[model samples]
Target: MTSYNKVNGKWTAENDYLLNEVLKKKWGFKGFVVSDWGAAHSTAGSAQAGLDLEMPFGEYYNDSLINKALQTGEIKEELIDDKIRRLLRVRFEAGMFGPQEKQTEGIFHSNLHKQIAYEAAVNGIVLLKNESELLPIDTGKVRKIAVIGPNAAFARIGGGGSSKVTPHYSVSPMEGLKNKLGNSVEISYALGAIIKNDVRIIENSFFENYNGKKGLKAQYFGNINCEGEPSYTRTDTEVNYLWYYDAPYWDFHGADDSNYFSVRWTGKIKAPKSGKYKFQVMHNDGARLTINGNVLINLWKDRRKSEIDEAVIYLEKGQVYDIQLDYYNNGGVSEIKLGWEIPDTDLIKEATELAKKSDLAILCIGLSDHFEGEGRDREFLILENQDKLIKEVVKANSNTIVVIISGTPPILETWVDEVPAIVQAWFAGQEGGNAIADILLGNRNPSGKLPCTFYKSQNDSPGFSDYQNDDLQSKYVEGIYVGYRYLDKHKIEARFPFGHGLSYSKFVYGKPQYALNENNKAEVKFTLTNTGISAGAEVAQLYIKPLNSQVERPEKELKAYKKVYLRSGESKEVIFELNQDDFKYYDTNIHDWQIDKSQFQLLIGSSSQDIRQTTTPKSL
Candidate 1:
């Protein structure tokens, strides 16, 4: 009912193509439909195509089109009544129709949704590698534990964006373990390096000796925004307010390079334990770590790299010295990292002697403000420091199991070899901490899988920048191939592969059954059985690939997926509809979604690469 930009005379009063056949025959999505802001051009056609509610509100939606559509008999008069009733039903069902109790933050603390989120987080964690049977820390074997790293103190609950959420609580791995172990373990923390820095932090108090020209720790300073010419203000304050962004900005890209964040911060570290102690630290933009003030590993500098920096510091029994680092970023994005590997061998040896004590070294890592802060174009040609955290921790302490908390998948190649387990804790709202804790304590079986592809290297991606301008316009140059589709289509392997997940328990799949109906849509049914000792959930993925195509297409696309929970030794049938849309593709030349009646291959599997059987669809 509302009209914004008619987009020249080329855009008709209605785009009937998408409404009648596509929404009906393809998506079968006839419900109380909502008109996207300014999407309503002709009320008669849109209503006939099933337009229900014209939102949000505008002059075009008022009376003229409504009366015209009714007078012309273009839309059933009863359709309006049905739509209103359906909207009311949904509103009441959501508990948003009237007032009852004032909703508070962390209101879902004890909600089943939170439990589901926690379970999803644990399942999303991918156990890339487990060498020497080094995991399952057996916290009872180590007495003295060293928890080091930026993440040890402040956990990254989510990135910065619409997906970003202020959780009711976020449980740092440090806090989670403390809750898990209680009084039996002794833990210490070390912040080996500062987060990204700039000249802004230098003007603040703590930096009397910590300027960018540093003597105390590592330091680097530059403009906050790296894009255009920076605005200068000599009368304001320090060297540059030109750098870093003011708070409350939005980043749909990766991170913004404009704004004053932290200054290059480097800290001289001290180890509390004498035995084998562990240290973990990660930074975006620029970072360098030195033990006894020597370069252990340096992965910093801002060149659009979004990998997480990490390291395991080995200490000489109770040997305490300075750990220094230097860093700065031109705003764009932010990242926070820190974790502990494990106690030194001698410490482990000593701990074993001390009443059989052992502590878990859980390195929780993910995207940070610097890596995913505020900007519209956050895509990077290089994965940043957060990408390195898991490798660093696993290399330092075989006992380390990293838990990644973010809204989306971060590239996972460099560190997969070192980690025995991974959990995708997608910004779990306010109860982040409690949810994370619940998963690590084995209270929940991870049942989540990759929602998107995790490229092994930036080189493997098709469009990782150098595409799209600032006009809020970007093309699907890859055509219908997105996510797993592109990976399989191009035969480019990913770090963890799509639809891959692991649980404490195991599952087995039986042959799949293909059932045809008179309509083009069909159903594929398969049996899943839990064969492990513990109850768990398994996510099954269905991939559809054109046997041969009139035009080039992705090797396979994710058509349907389902997650089934089964107790130990339980089995259930998982059925999914193979609708006509499953066989559809966006033809750029035609500017429409098309489906070929040619042969299609349906591969049902545990992961994208683990197809157990293949089937074909019946054409209408």
Candidate 2:
């Protein structure tokens, strides 16, 4: 699919050189190219540039625009036919047209899929820092465990935007620990800090209906205004609804249309504490909030996207104030959330106190979809308020383990020295909780490695200044020096090197042996022995360093890697076959790939900076 980014100042959807020449002709990509939602700019230009499909109802590629473009001889009929053929070829090759097999019942959330998710979460978790081997918590000695942080209770299955999915079930870190330890260990929890600055949703415990129920009385109306008798009435647990593509009470009344609908929620809200409170109403179309018969927010207008309107008011502790929320949906995606920011509580203090009393403290903290995602690029590598949380928690409890749940690397220099152990669990799937528990309890050995170098700060990273460029056009400033290559070239030390990961068991690598075969491929062999008592897997990375090259090159480029698992005291011989293409580099002068007939050094190691053995391969 064509991305939202641009190449050489031209949008990817409209770039012919990228979509057609490089992708289709050079790479021979047989699949049809589809543009990202709203990425297609011109119907004729994009279609001619090999964009076979425009997604999400196609604003530019509509029938009228296409027909007009065709009439003007801009987009040929042959091009359209080719696009259709490519699309159909994929479907036909996938057996979609001939599919007659009956799908297995309960296959959507089958146990087999759940087990696969568990295994993936287990293997993908990277042990970044394990100072003095503080991880693999001794459950027998640690009778009391304190799980602290905002993300401890909720399972962060994935990031937001188009990549988000509704899992059948998810286990949070807190729940996972409880399930793993059972009654043998006593667990306590404290919310250290919230990840986002927005107000949290008011819990259902704070609301009470007229009938003294633990929820608000909701009345759904078919019309835009709640003027007549309601179409449906129910006790809604909360004033939060993401009624996308359907109106309120859609299931009960079968109201297919979401364009015209209104809802009224009547309830009594009790203040948890006596202080000033900020109430927020996030809505898409129109919404209003009234407390004690006084209108707080009157945003009764259409909105293209969901927006939040907040009002601050003072309320006494334990006082029941009458609250009413009126909402109407007049368009696209429908969503409404009534939230509030209560008076400041000593959340950190509470967590510290709990940590001091517990035998072990596990801080689950990291970025969520709100901080980082497809379109949401984080401004800083440091997690907001989490470094302070970790610092404070570690001071209270000497034995602390930090579990980072994120899709990207977060700077841990602030509290990394203080913490004994740290685990990088990157948006683990549905079984993430169980996987984390297994790692902590020593049921599974960690073998995952960092895919990218973790810079100490944003300034130390390559292309740091270019990322902040406001202009639409981005110059290729960094060029080939990216990630570890840039760091290696500049002799900049990283917080954690690429392919860096900790395992309970240690592996020793023997001297590498290499020879050129009759096929002109370099065959390398090495022996790996599990020195530690624990059994684990090791990812052996092979890097190729050019001895003398006409053109400038990186310090070393990763050519091949293999993950080898061995039991304690077990030794295995690992082999890697390197072809001619692996030694070739792109020659910009010739606009093609070329290989230099010079000696090359092969470095084998666990990480980019941890080379164990080196061998020189004969020149071609």
Candidate 3:
């Protein structure tokens, strides 16, 4: 599918050089191309450029528009038939034109699929730091385990936007530990910090309707502005709703159109404590809040992105206040949530105290979709208030394990040295909690490797301004010097190098043997032995360094890699076949890939910085 971004200053959907010249002709992609949602710009332009389909109901690629374009000679009828032919060819190759198979019941969400998810989550977890081999917590020695931090109670299944998934069942980190250790070990939990800026949803007990009922009265309108009569009226236990692709009252009245809608909720709120309260509303389009006839927040304007607006007001205990909220959805992905933060509490102190009394502390802290996700970019990589939380928890309980839950790497320079063990558990799937438990309890040896370099700070890499121009253009000034290449070129050390991951068991590599085969392919062979007592998997990476070249190149470039699992005292011979294409570099001057007859240094290792064997081989 064509992406939402542009290539060479032209929209991908309408770029003929990219779609027709490069994708279709040069690469020989026979399948028809589809544009992303709302990505199509012009019917004639996109159709001529090889865009065969427009996603989620077309605005420009409609039948009327296409027919108009063809009639006006802007697009040819032959091109339209070719697009349909490609699509039909793909369907025919998949046997769709043949016999129809009977649909199988209970195929989806089966036990086999669950097992695959569990294995994927287990293998994708990377072990970053294991000081003193403190992980694989000895359940017999540690009686009480304190699970602290914001992400401990809930399972962070995945990031937001299209990546989010709804599993049949999910297990939180706290629940996983209990399920693993059972009653043999006492487990405690405490919220160390509030990572999300928005507060929790207001409880149902705190609200009352006009009839003294236990929920707020909601009135829904079909238009953006609340006008005339209400289309629907209902009682909502809480003012939290994420109507992603459906309008309000979709389930009850089948109003699937989410383009324009508004809702107003009215109730009375009573504070449990007399203190300053911070009220917040997380919405996509527009929202307003009022209490006792005073408008606290009035953001009644169309918003293209999701945002959080807040206000602080003092409320008295035992006194009831009239509360009202108005929300409107201008377009896509509707969401509105009313929440508040009460008086401040010493959460860090409480967590530290619990850690001090426990035998061991497992701190679950990291970024979620709230901090980084689609349509949002984090201002900084360091987790907010989590560095301090880690520092304090480690000081209280020396035996602490830091489990990080994020889709990307986070800066850990502040408290990384103080922590004994650290696990980088990327947004695991439905069985994420159980997978993390497996790694922590030594049921599985971590074999996951970092796909990119982790810099110590943002300054260690190229400045963001270097890549973004004032004319709203992205500049690849670093060229091929990205990730580990940039670090290697600048002689800067990484916090953790690319492809770096630690395992419970260790492996040793023998000297590599290189030879050219009859087909002129470089054949490299080596033996890997599991020296440690425990069984584990090792990801062997092959890198090539140009010993002689006319153009400048990075220190090394990864060509191929393989993951080999070995038992204790077991050895296996690994082979890798490489052709001349693997050593060729893209030459912009010639507008093609070019290879030089030069001797290249072949380095085999577990990580980019940990090469174990080296051999010199000439380019095939």
Reference-based TM-score of each model: 0.58, 0.87, 0.83
Per-residue C-alpha lDDT of model 2 across residues 281-398, encoded as one tens digit per residue = 8788899999999899999988867778999999999999999999988865677888887887777898999999999999999976656666666765677677788999999998
lDDT of 3 by residue, 342-422 (tens): 776577897999999999999999877677667656654777677889999999999999999888888899988899999
Clashes of each: 85, 0, 0
In the range 190-239, model 1's lDDT, one tens digit per residue, is 33223332000212221223334322442222343222322321111112
Off by over 4 Å in 3: 93-103, 201-344, 462-465, 618-620
CA lDDT scores, all candidates in order: 0.56, 0.85, 0.85
Better-scoring candidate (lDDT), 1 or 3:
3
**Deviation in angstroms for 558 in model 3?**
0.9
Candidate 2: segments with Cα more than 4 A from true spot:
100-102, 201-344, 517-520
lDDT score for residue 105 of model 2? 77
Colliding pairs, model 3: none
lDDT agreement of model 3 with the native:
0.85
Model 1: worst 10 consecutive residues (lDDT sum): 198-207
